[model samples]
Target chain A: MASRSPLLAALMRLPPPAPVLMAGSHLLTRLGRKMAGRHPGMIARLGPEAGKRLLLDATDLPALILLQAEPLSLRLFPRRAAAPPSDAQITGNLAAFLAMLHGESDGDALFFSGELSISGDTSAVLALRNALDDAEIDLAAEFAALFRAPETVVRRLAVVAGPRLGLSLTRMEALP
Target chain B: MMELVCPAGTPAALRTAVEAGAHAVYCGFADETNARNFPGLNFSRAEMAEGVAHAHARGAKVLVAINTFPRAGDADLWHRAIDDAAGAGADAVILADMGLLDYARRAQPQLRRHLSVQAAASNADAINFYAREFGVKRVVLPRVLTVAEIDEINREITVETEAFVFGGLCVMAEGRCSLSSWTTGLSPNMNGVCSPASHVSYETTPEGQDARLGGVLIHRTPAGGPAPYPTICKGAFTSPDGAGGRQTGHIFEDPVSLDATFLIPMLQKAGVRALKIEGRQRSRAYVAQVVRTFRAAVEAADRGAEMPVGALAKLTEGQASTTGSYAKIWR
Candidate 1:
């Protein structure tokens, strides 16, 4: 038989689905909530704060749109938000989010460079920085393990492609 | 007999080195306060305190590195690190930032402070300036200096000197490069992360493969070839020359580690106090093996025995090493 793809081989060897997804989703939710909570004031300013709807267009396959609030949750929003007016538009991919958190990329630059965008509240965007500064998300162990994982090829590819697409889209969006 | 200081990124690594005869083991909080801020590495405040106690019990000292520069308007975190290190019974604090060094010297006059290699004290004048102004007791010399330069520095300065003997190397002048900042906006001086993993990615493409960091294409290896990490200085790029020729491949350095094992006697004669081994991200097994090897070498040098042949060839990256600037050819 043809050798199973490396990623497939790795995934198949995983100890079943429920435990893996549960653990992964739990980590994601906890980190997302921690990030959101750390910048409560900023999170509040993004729309109504309590019920603000934000869209994160990852610009990658299996594109993700996140709706963030007091209790943070993530879902794949299909067909985009139809003129419903999002408080902010976080473009780019997971790498951009990671870079922004690491203080490597500023929100303003991300927005101006079209790596990220915002429409409803500029003050809300500023608040995001404040929140990140006040909060600490520990992803070192998780990130290290993820990098060492054999199935990391998919995510790694996305990390490389995401920023390229985001930058290109940002430029295209900026053109008249 | 000057003290031989070494690096330890984890508690297990610290204990391993201390047991294997490290006179001093330097570490940092599991955060940006240290240079080797790799994931799943470094010590917690409590762990540091415990490690200090253990090292002290074994007659070894613990030095804390708050080496990275403080961000603009965010000096409190750095200050807290200094206070925490002092409270944890650290033997000394290694610092790089002028402002932070000044702060530590003033705020805690009793805390012994050493200048970090990140400060890049390549010359005697700079070393003397830091010693005289900030009362720095020692200066970890940057890897760019030669044995003669180190001897010259010792002759001119009262402070002790330290140098790296093994592991990874930096080609750029420390504290000066902004490559990471230019691409990622996170300054290594301020953020203490170099070529942070968050911005790095490896992808397989029909046109071979690519490794990129922060959206910049750093390397493209052919299929079935090894892809080195996208460290900015070691990236492959095409620089068009004014003479209408283009240069490709590692404008700075090839993907190789530094191994200066053959230069120990020369370094000792040049008034070197400590020899550092990098790689805080390495396994405890790796740390134990390296510490044991170096410990034996140091002992052999003290007894005037013939130096042992190299035993760490397999541990080096890409199975290659360089004497780096210690031979002075680059200068």
Candidate 2:
């Protein structure tokens, strides 16, 4: 294979069985290996409080997660008990999970529909809700750097579908 | 003596109120033109005219409410409501929206206009702005002001002031809330409905019975417990504490109604022109009981008699009532 890019080299250096990325129904495991050589700080802003509060107040939460999907891959586990080789895994389906975060889908309804099943603290899920409302995620800048990448098809699909689906689903869910 | 304006949702309620010695009675068209757009309530235009005739013959005034905001591109309905109220010989028409106020002032300069509580004019500056701009003769202050604040406002304003003595309490500032719209796509300002019944759903599970509005779980009561309607702000929610624990309960307000009956004397002394009772969705019997009780209280106040003990407790929502932002210390 051609010499891996510097970004990929840095990502590979991180301890991993590696994270997975799930886009809508499409699932990709161990995808973060591609960016092994990249500086973590280039994207990960330091400090837990800053990160926590930023996520708590984000308005465009689904958009942020959708953009992140293009550059990072995460593993999907059936339950919290399932052994994961890496500690940095992020997992969830794009369409339904994003819908719930936007307040378009109710937790009870999605749980009943078997559309949402999470192994994490539900409070952490709510924290994500608050964070999305609190965070100021700039999709333009974040996506600009990754727009031309070969893997951006899923990200582009999410960009087009997330808001429209969220809005329509909210209306559907609102109706008696 | 300050006028005691009581609610009259039906013709029987109108007669009950007039008989019980209300100084004035306020009702609305049997349509969306009014704020209390509850089903099977309010009066028809003919009913209103007859009710006015009855109240007038009894030496009491009648005010018509055309208080809800007019929809975008559909101002004609509200204009017609104003004209109808004027044609029916209402003593005054209570209004809220600025555009509607201007239209009424231009269309029927001879008719008196009372500012509706939905305007949420809690301060003298806003009250003066309305009075100077629309020639508003009186203002029904929002439920958010304390007696001291009301006194301070009366000291500055030229128009007459009305304050709520009893009924439903709105915790949020009126005419400016969107929490209802965010949940149900309907709003008090736009649809004359808050926490509309159509969007509410209840579900029973092994854990509890969940009350939902627009599909969001707002409250979960024990299986056989009474389920309060899920009004967004009053709903139970979990909030995180600084030390990594959860605080679960009503972070805003508990489910309680407002009853400021004991403050009548203080309100009158504060230069109030009227004390308003706030339930057009209420039954005629409820109206009669409340009107009779308040009439006695107001008469006693006028004659310098001691205020009566509580008699309207059963009429309150949740079987519990509050003075609601009136004490200021509650804040």
Candidate 3:
């Protein structure tokens, strides 16, 4: 499994400015909707747990993310902003979160390694993790699809760039 | 040669385990029919069938775990799970409850039965009784047995024995712990979860990160440090030190998982037929890596080669592991 990316941490020495944050948040919101649309089974799999509000705190990033699961909405808040009320929170660095999202690292290993922190309603967090794992989301592919870019080229670029940049851009090799 | 029995919480994990060289993959339905019934985990009936077919296609067996005790006035649910597992083409059904075992024997004699570790059958007499009465072909020995004791039991019993070689170590006798139920009103034997996540919470207090189970503070880690899961047995606590003021520590058990990779050959020599890994609620990535590692270890043990040790330290709970009762170091 890919360890947490030190290169990513080094790059986040300065938080992104407000305009960039706004633009990224807008893009991510649309991406979240698209992902929910593309993988309806993931949401449905949560059963009665679809209404949970989860906080994703990337300790190295500029802002924290508050994700509302039912409507598939994602909103960003400055790291220093008043914390929103959430059912649960998962705190980790960007690389660890991305690696878990892309199946490059195991969530339990990350937690066991002290790279991730979990608080609040752990069952909701577990539900989200299981749903995301089943969905098999590929961050690189999701961005490529959202931008109408050719998936193969983007995938090749991600496969080449991901390691160097300390990111898990694409899904790990599928199990045979 | 000891078979590698891997756990799968989902169909994807099942496929991953089979591809990773598991001789047999164990799983359960998406209900309280088995332990590790965490949210969004386990398989539906259709998925179980497909998973069985997938594993079988790769020359691997699938064992469905309907291991939870059937609730009073709700045994039909457990009965249906057994029938569905058999229908899904399971090679065996791991069961713990006596009623369920007898039911499986009478209702589906063709389906093999493996006594679950939850039965806590740690001796030759109890194991032999289960084999004779319920036609149990294999018995998953509780984690409390030492290698010498296991060897002694093997000498007296006829059924194949399976022992946990890796993963979580219960502080109490398997299937008999009531700590979670006393605290949260949910028991693994009945509800299929110990320390059910719904009752667990964590917070960063002035002192440290506090983990609470059922609104009771269990563990307090140093500020910004990693906190272990709030299972009652693994929790930190404070109690009056008899004549003195008070003492605080993990009074029951430390937050460490069981890792017996170094004892594979010993367990094999003890007549263990299969080695079991314990995280059905873990991710597919975790399952794949662990199964692959144990497969190599099992193969090496067969070849009389040195087994890989400490390869899974990063994957263990609190990044710490113990040989558990296998070494009997306390004795």
Task: Give the DockQ (2 decimals) of all models.
Answer: 0.03, 0.01, 0.65
What is the iRMSD in Å for candidate 3? 1.6
Summing lDDT over every window of 10 consecutive residues in candidate 2 chain A, give the lowest-scoring window.
A49-58
For candidate 2, the TM-score is 0.62
How many pairs in model 3 have backbone atoms within 3 A of each other, for residues 3 or more apart or on separate chains, i.e. clashes? 0
Between candidates 1 and 2, name the one with more favorable lDDT: 1
User: Against the hidden true structure, what lDDT does model 3 obtain?
Assistant: 0.88
- Residue A75's C-alpha lDDT in candidate 3? 80
Considering the two chains of model 2, state its CAPRI-style docking category.
incorrect
The order of the candidates by lDDT, greatest first, is 3, 1, 2
lDDT of 3 by residue, B1-331 (tens): 7899999987778888998899999999988889988898989899899999999999999999999998778899999999999999999999999999999999999999999999999999999999999999999999998999999999999999999999988989889999999999998898899988898887866776788889998888886555566788989889998988998988879889999999999999989999999999888888888999999999999999999988888888878899999988643
- Put down candidate 1 lDDT per residue, B1-331, tens digits, no spaces: 4365766766766886787778889888867877766544567788789999999999999999999988778889889999999999999999999988999999888999999999998898999999999999989999988888899889999998988888777878977778887898877777877777556655546776566778898877665443344577877898887799997778777867777777888888898988888766554445656777887777777776666656865556544678888886633
lDDT of 2 by residue, B1-331 (tens): 8799998766656776788789999998866788765434567778788889999999999999998999888999899989999998999999999999999999999999999988988899999999999999999998888899899999999999998888767778977888878998887776777766456655546775566777887877663343333577767888897689988787767766677777888888899989998876554446667887888888888887887756876556444578988887724
For model 1, the stretches where C-alpha displacement exceeds 4 angstroms are A1-176, B205-209, B222-227, B239-247
Output the better candidate (1/2) by DockQ: 1
Clashes of 2: 28
Error of 1 at A91 (Å): 30
Model number with the top lDDT: 3
**At residue A146, what lDDT does model 2 achieve?**
36
Model 1 steric clash total: 2
Candidate 2 per-residue C-alpha lDDT over A1-100 given as tens digits, one digit per residue, 9 for 90 to 100: 1233466445534432223324421332232322222323212221121222111111222211221322444333323233444312123244444444
TM-score each candidate. 0.64, 0.62, 0.95
